[model samples]
Target: MARVQFENIYKRFGKVEVVHDVSFDIKDKEFMVLVGPSGCGKSTCLRMVAGLEEPSEGQIYIGDRMVNGVDPKDRDIAMVFQNYALYPHMTVFDNMAFGLKLRHFPKAQIQKRVEEAAATLGLENLLKRKPKELSGGQRQRVALGRAIVREAQVFLMDEPLSNLDAKLRVETRANIIKLHQSIQTTTIYVTHDQVEAMTMGDRIAVLNGGVIQQLGTPQELYDRPSNMFVAGFIGTPGMNFFPGAKVVAEGDTTKIVLDGMGQVEVPADYAKIARDAAGKELTFGIRPSHLEDAALVGEDSQRSSIDGTVDVVENLGNELQVYLTAGGKNIIATLDSRSRVVAGNKVKLYVENDRMHLFDTATGEAFF
Candidate 1:
């Protein structure tokens, strides 16, 4: 395993720049995920590391070597693409051993390596089967096995689980994590799915508009987003944003006034942050999970409650996602599965004050 570093990397196609001064370090044996929406340049960034694409400027390092001019084959990196690029005519064993064979490795060593990789990936019984004869999951495993047999210092996977069914994707995801753990190969994964990035990456780099918006652990990105875009993009159901809200001070306390919903008291620390911005427009953000049914909360709970008309109620077995419309603003609350709320019902929802996020109306930067 080796450390991978991108220093002020920029990529451009003609006059249109797709990547802008992106920089980050992937430690030895660390699983780093590059995640964003389509056209965000995540795949381009990964391609640069694999020597498939050259950066317009800046330098890239694999371990202690500068690999800017190195050929892809000589980079000592193995890449697993989105499509399982296996040879249909070759058996799994031959597919896995093709690289070693091309490099003129000994017959015994190739056999040993292929067998070891097959055993590691639980493909011992399917070594004789062709790619066309295997299931999607199996084919994907064969592709991964092909990479594993190389035993390269780094592994670059680009949406390797995108083609699998939902259940199969979950299974394959677990398998990939296990493989990384067992082998401890430095891995850089590219995915557009936030859930996959959150679950699989040791540290995630969130990109947008050809820029690195945030880089941190999943928990850090989820709990303390740097800006409105990061806050809204990293969560399931996204964050409910209420615009044009004002901060009002009552005595020594501060409160945020939601037009249709009642006032929500700010915590002391937040009150200090909001005091100078009183009467100015600000954006209010609250995650669905931080909102709960007020009726179910303890009486002594310090949460601030607001009233809204339920627009929809989705029961997700273990939890209920309640969509509400208050004062022309839409909000969603994720509550217990036992919640009895229904469409058109007027319900009281409680917000955890300390968990609320405030952003500048114009700049979209978080206030606290």
Candidate 2:
């Protein structure tokens, strides 16, 4: 029953506005992530929710109560910060039990809660170890264990896995996911990493310049980005952009013409829109994965193809990352590793016509 809601929230410091008109609801037992670059107001929003900072305008609700002025201790929420924040001298059990002890809980009850959380996080064997004795991942688990023993209605995690190494990050990520499934607590996680957002969140809120660009499930943001920013920011290598392109009708076929490169026949489904935009400048976008070596495609395939000189080829065992210059612009393509394409070679790239994207050059809004 611990659903969190932000209604038209805004935050400002002096003359500078940070968070702008942000509104979203995190349902009970849902895992939500606030993702963006540094200074994007993601951490500020989380702080507002935690009662560490108050919004300049709008209401914040946790469950049935409006908690605008509530103290962090009274918010019925547990927060795990980027730093483990453990007492260095205390053993794992003591650190986990500290909060409960501060509130003067019965010794037996405190022991039971701490032991249960320890077991949940697989820290039973390390109960006697101090924070300095534990590894990065282990220390993170202790932080999580400390939060869990509270059995709070909501959990707020801010970049909890960023401190871990790459391999440990993956392992800790899985552990957090498993922990969420087991407890079913309403959780809001914040991170700058899209991979973490994609893998951990049930829904993601993408923010930039203190504004939320889009809020939806990860797949929705990926497959159907509402604007150029979300489209470019969500993917790994990101969607490629060809600026100042134009759409025009040549006979019955509508083609997107890129200066100095070539034209691509627009798919039938998008022909009308392309036709309507004829002679006007637009940005064409396509993912690297959608481009492939033309030689490998069947000769009779209807894929629109373009030619580019390969600048570099990165063989990644399973796939090849090829960087090429096309139409006076740099383009990246993820292709099959077995293909013989190499640096300094001129190669034809097949574009997945149906997967192409168009955006208004001025506003950076998607046309899909």
Candidate 3:
């Protein structure tokens, strides 16, 4: 296990710089994921640490040693590429043993390492077969096994499961989690999918436009996001935003009336936050999961419910996704699986007062 650190990291492609002053630390044996949309410089950051790409500025360290100028192999890390990169003609066993053989490990030692790695990845039964004989998931496991045989200090995976089918991707994700628990090796994974990052990482770093927007444990980032981008990016179905809303004070309670969306009473603690927004434009945020069918929720102090006409219904087996247009505002809610809500019908929807997130429209920063 090793601690990985990036110090004010920067990358450049000719005169057009990509990554800008990026910095973060991955604790020893932690499963940390860097995630964002395409061209966000996440894969580029991983490549720099792997020594496959040089840092335009700053330094990268693995454990206590600076590895800025170290060769990729000498960095004592194993990388599982997205493409799998398996040799077409080589048997799975040879592919797993290739690195050790190149390093001139004794035949018995190489066999032991490969066999153990094969078993760990459940590839033992396919060792004699070539990659062409295997399924996409099986081939991916072979790629993982190849890295496992190295027993490197750190592991770097760059969207290795992207090529697998949805079901296989989920299974492989679970397998990777179990593998990490058993091996306890430090890993830095990069992906553009937020679902993978949330499920697989102990902590996630959300990146956008070549800079990290937020970094924290999955729950921390979800519950207490630092900014609008993160709040919107980290959640499934994303967070709902009503721009140019007005905050109006009603007696002791602080309230914000959304555009075409009804007024939501704010908590007393947040009253001061909304007080400064007399005539200024404000953005109100609410997560999809927090928006519930009024019949399913209480008129309690938790939230305020308003009426909406169902626009669409997405039945996702275990749960129902109800899209509605209320107060002239469009929103989605994950309702109970047995929900009888249908399109064109009207139903009451609750927007929790305490769960309301207010942001300055211009800066996109959450109002504390």
Candidate 3 residue 184 Cα shift, in angstroms, is: 1.2
lDDT of each: 0.90, 0.91, 0.87
Kindly report which residue stretches of model 2 are placed more than 4 angstroms away from their true locations once superposed. Answer: 250-252, 299-303
Per-residue accuracy of model 3 over 1-368 as CA lDDT, tens digit each: 79999999999999988999999999999999999999999999999989999999998999999999899989999999898789899999999999999999999999999999988889889999999999988988899999999999999999999988899999999999999998989999999999999999999999999999989999988887888999889989988887877888877877787655567888888888689866666888888788777776666524466567999999999888988886677878888776688899997777766787888888788784
Which ten residues in a row are the worst by lDDT in model 1?
298-307
**Model 2 residue 99 lDDT score:** 96
Cα error of candidate 2 at position 281, Å: 2.6
TM-score of 3: 0.95
* lDDT score for residue 160 of model 2: 94
- Candidate 2 lDDT at 225 equals 87
Q: For candidate 1, lDDT tens digit of each residue in 45-104?
A: 999999989999999999999999999999999999998689889999999999999989
What is the TM-score of each predicted model, taking all chains together? 0.96, 0.96, 0.95
